[model samples]
Target: MFEELSQYLGWTNCFPEGESFLVIAEGTDCGFILQHFIHTFLKRKLPVCLVSTSQTFSHYSQAGIKIGANLDKAREEKSIHLVDLMSKFLNHYTGQIECDWNAKNIYLSIKEELDSMEISANSILIVDDISVLSSLCLSIDDIGNLLHYLHALSKQRGFNILMSIPSLDCEQVQDTQSIAEHYADTVLCVKSLQTGYSKEVHGQIEVVKGGRSNCGVRQYKLSDKNLHLFARGTSMAVL
Candidate 1:
């Protein structure tokens, strides 16, 4: 499956080194895609740090599944760390209003935790719905700066960063995605299609970009506890 995607995107490696950004539309199986890629291709038994503002992690856990590594084993090994920013922020505050200082403090807390980890270059950091982070603490420009800083830090430490942005709120996250697409080594856009009058599910993907101009998008499916890629129609040249 990955072989087909690698060929379509002209990528030499399936899970390439450095930071990669992936954006998904709402209700798409973005989390599943990330989990499958890490479990199937990486071949590393390292922990996956999920930094999320939404209840995505909780939702996945409730579904009797996890993103990466065995949940029980990870818990035993103290590997998987689920940081719920919203909960943490609300817990730290007493008033109904939110403050920028409080938000910065949360960011610092996450940074400190990441700094303390003994993870290597193979470890993955999944920042689900960075749009929430942007809306909470910083302006659009500041969010871009923060993302650049995170990308640089990840590259320096040899860790991979996977971030998600919802397409429905694209205006709120367009700058973040644009910065990621330009700075990160790779960018993947996960999209879904509805076909026929009956709303039949047509296809989904992990469309790769930011290298070769004429590369084509590959079709990927996440079902039956597996992720596989196949040849699909080509997208516009990303030059």
Candidate 2:
């Protein structure tokens, strides 16, 4: 689904073990980025534990189908494990299950899911849009502590972590996002073009690996079966 993006980013090898990967989606949906990671890791036959905070399992399954990765089949095969926080939250709201929707409980649940997975260097943990925790009335401290715990877990288990968050206005949210970025080995910042939407390009992605010293920006357009990456300032519409 993201072969061009992967090749451009030199993801020939799996992501470095035990590193945090952050993606900040601003003015655009970064679902494709998350999907890319899942598809890539699963294609490599690596175990993936996806923590879906904002979307349901079925939502991802449908997206996976479009990308040629059958998430439902993967789950049946135990190749992918899902921590469906969205369903948990919904059940709690509808008086179905007594779920303590706090950061501690969430962290413990995620830890439990990761524990159930076959831990190895090739394992990948993907968290879709962590900032949604704020909507559950979690404090900034709670979010910070959650990230710290996840990072520690990754280090102890030797698996890479991937997380995405929308660019937000609240200072507290931004602080939490910054903390994630500081801990990240690679950060992908996705933002809309100033000139607004174009048939040629959807948005720009600024890739920061290790640090800002190593950064590259690319324009991209999303399709049903591909993510077309363009060199900075170039457009495929003309061709």
Against the reference, the lDDT scores of all candidates come to: 0.59, 0.85
List, residue by residue over 1-239, the lDDT tens digit for candidate 1. 23444454454565455656565554464665555544533345665676767755556454325333455445456576666676755654667665564335655766776876776777777777776755565677667667767777787888777777776655767676666667656666667755322122235555555564335555554444544565554322111
Q: Model 2: per-residue lDDT, tens digit, 1-239?
A: 58888876667564566777899999889998988888888898889999988998898899999878899999999999999888888888889999767778989999998888888886899999888887777788888888988988898888999999999898777887988987798888899988898987999888888777344688888898988888776786766
Per-model root-mean-square deviation over C-alphas: 5.4, 1.7
Which segments of candidate 1 are over 4 A away from where they belong?
1-15, 37-43, 63-69, 89-106, 194-202, 211-215, 233-239
Index of the highest-TM-score prediction = 2
Give the TM-score (vs. native) of candidate 2: 0.94
Winning candidate number (lDDT)? 2
